[model samples]
Target: MQVQPLDIVVVGGGAFGAASALELAERGHHVTVLDRTASPHPDASSTDISKMIRMDYGADVFYHELAEASLDVWEAWNADWPRALYHPEGFLVLSAREAEPGSFEFESERVLRERGYDPQHFDAEHLRSVWPVWNADRYPEGYVSPRGGWAESGAVVARLLKLGRGAGAGFVAGSFASLLEDGSRVSGVRYVAEDKSVRTLKADRVIVATGAWTPVLLPWLSDVLKPVAQPVVHYGVDDASRWQSPVFPPFAADMAGSGWYGFPALDDGRIKLGHHADGCVVDPEHRGTVSEDHLDLARVFLAESLPELADAPVVGTRVCLYSDSFDGDLWIGEDPERSGLIVAAGGSGHGFKFTPMIGKLVADTIERRENPWLHRFAWRSLAEPRQEAARMQH
Candidate 1:
């Protein structure tokens, strides 16, 4: 079976676009990636200091399997890249109550054990002895899995773009205006160039990987895809050593219940914390500042979970926008109504960790290749929004 290489254009240069461009170009396609800004767009969700890398999806075995596969590639990237971007220190899944059935902590541990991985269970006493920074009494049941950790997300995106360019994918800076169509088939893209001039790039196929802006670009999908904004805050710590790995790894503090999670301190002593709950709908162009209510909630959570960080000076803050679908699962398949058009979006806040696998997934979808995971992400009718298992209920 001889497949012809076609000219392809990918919109967005974040994790999905960069990964897709790299994969498509490597597969012999003439690929071009267009973005409003350069790679690692400052406002893009993928442009963050750190993102958790864990296979703990509670009872969702599908995501757990995908994450496990992604982790193997993350390790391989760490070994092959110019510098290590992924830190495999470990991940602590802390629960405020006992590991009861149907709980995120319990299901994650049970699934890990069932798959032959030994996640170390911990109690109040163990937390006090091993990770003294945590309020032992607040987190009574938890587990630490050595298989997961965090990654420098922005750096990873940059690396992927660089790799994509090196693999013969063209990079262009422009703001996408609309999909150019020849009748019912998408022919290419019309964009506003850096100099404010209109430009058009023709392609045999077009992949729109524009994260939170997906719904905005394709208004027809507005009902199924939305832009939701989540808050992320960074606090400066006086003692970085106490908050670094081997002491305090990346962790979820009753995440499914409280939506609170944080990473270990960076070299400059900044600890990044974020909430993964039901965020308010937002316009991608006008993503507002983090609300006072969210900061107040963070303060309260810290006061009870990590007392030392309760009043730590706020170093930075940002509203990370997610391309949320009706269901939390990603959308990556050709548009049924439009020939030569494919979409790859719906990050939903948990997509960065799967960067390594996203490219292959997008490539598979583009080629109509037989992949086991493609069916789950294909375009379909909207249903009741069933978010990921680890997402918190507000």
Candidate 2:
């Protein structure tokens, strides 16, 4: 229904893309969102039932602050829409009692304290008292955050897509072919629609939020962004009451060691669980099917660490793809080789929580707005590998 050249063309309709389209459209830019699948449809990161979000990432101060801001945004939007987009069940970081004071959990507690945010540290007995259903003996200590939880990504993506559509942004189901380039500047995108017809949409600016598909579209940046496949599983709580849940926070297994993680019981009678670190390197198109072994790996960790819900039966499984940058941080800025093209991907695994601010940053970059955080995450800055980034202390 739009006639003139669009102000921005966004490739990929996942959370980042939808959020980008929503923000740009809200800014009065005629926007077009192109995706092979429908918005919030399967295969997109945003549609996966839930994505764990919290402010206890340990050492990543920028991400920690951004997460806090994002929580406020999610809460406000949930209230405004009167919808359950975010399930604010809070989060827990589990670790050993004497596991060095400088570890990520310890540093996170320090950071939270400095910011006037209290993260309660509990011992085995305290953990038992707090969560009787969980096995306190598995870990000596745990840090509980009253202000973190999981977001129903699919629902949020659906809401944003709807809002964007209502705001005059066009959503077309198609496969993004390539960037329409005039030398170094990107003009628009060519896509094959659902009916197999190829159409070209022209725009002044292009934002690529293809998630795991970022490197494929921009082959030149293959070394910068590596799409990784992360498998997540959901287990049904056989006896919900058997676990003295205590509003079981979104938990991360041994913040020092990348292992188990899970959510509180949802209204749908399923709890989400996954690994915070380990995942297979897989391609977006030819990814492996979620299998029983994947589910077992998640279950085994939860059982050993948090014995309360270990015996739960597997309910469902999903694969989460992370566009990992060389430094394991996010890449959100203009491409070095292309003008008028803003590349925003490289989630690694923890990008979902900051979708709102990321959308704002991508919009700002497209509009040439000055922002400190956006500047820090630019393409040029990411040229150097962040080895310390992998050992996040926030």
Candidate 3:
């Protein structure tokens, strides 16, 4: 089935939009990426110092497989890009108690083994010997997957935008206002340009990949999509070498129970930590600062888990917003009611790791291609909200 190249307007130039633009343009479609800023918007979730790039999805084999596929591309990108942004140091999953059935750490290791990957299981003694920073008593058992690590998120987005442009995708700086509709079909988008002038972009298809702003821009999705703000903080350590790789790697500290996870120190000696539990619902336009309660919680967790970092100076704090879906699965596909409107949102806080694969997944959706992974992200009716397996239930 031969299809004609369509003129597509992708709203929001975050990971989803930028990647989709690159893939779509490469496939010969006319793509124009409209974003709030030039590239890597400061407030966008995709614009971060570092994000975990792991294939540990607990018992969810679907995401595990998707992440496995993405990891291959991530490695390829490292080879193709001018400089490597993804650092495959490894990921350590820790548990306070011994690994048991149904636990996130247990399931993740079990799944990895089932999929033919060797994860090194360790007891507290082994962990203490390898990563001395951890409180051995607090984390008695866990495993480390040598294949997982972290990516410089903002840099990855910038690279994607550059590649997309080279592939013939155009970029427009503007704030999305509304969809321009012709009858029941979305024919274009109306946005406020950077110069304060109102403008319109006509397209054969419109992809709304605006992240947390999805429900706000498209009110009909409010029931299913929500904007959630999670707290993230960076601590400055005196000796960064002690916190870096081979000694310390990206880690989840009893994450399923405590919602605490952190990365090894950056070159400048700052360690990043975030909570992956239920966040407060917020309006993207008026998202407030990280709550004092959240900060207090982080302090307590550090005091118990990593005493060395408990008193470290706070370098930065942010309220990271996530576009949460009723179910944690991503939303990607055409609208059932609107003919030309497609949505590529619902990152739900774990989308950045799959950056390498999202574009092709979205492109397949747009072209109505038969992709095995497409069904997991397709638009559907709302249901009881279920967090992704790796996320903590608070």
lDDT by residue (tens digit), candidate 2, 147-260 = 877888888888888988988899878888988999988899998988899899898998889988898888887877877777777778755544324656667767557666
**Candidate 2 Cα outliers beyond 4 Å, as residue runs:** 1-6, 239-245, 291-293, 381-394
Q: Where is model 1 more than 4 Å wrong at Cα?
A: 383-394
Per-candidate clashes, comma-separated: 0, 6, 0
Give candidate 3's whole-model lDDT: 0.89
Comparison by TM-score, 2 against 3, better one:
3
- List, residue by residue over 87-195, the lDDT tens digit for candidate 3: 9988999998987899888998999999999999999999888887888989989899869899999999999999999999999999999999999999999999999
lDDT of 1 by residue, 270-365 (tens): 999999878889998899998888889999988988998889988999999988877888889899899999999988788888889999999888
The models' CA-based lDDT, in order, is 0.90, 0.76, 0.89
The C-alpha TM-scores of every prediction are 0.97, 0.92, 0.97
Which candidate order results from sorting by TM-score in descending order? 1, 3, 2
Q: List the residue pairs that clash in candidate 1.
A: none
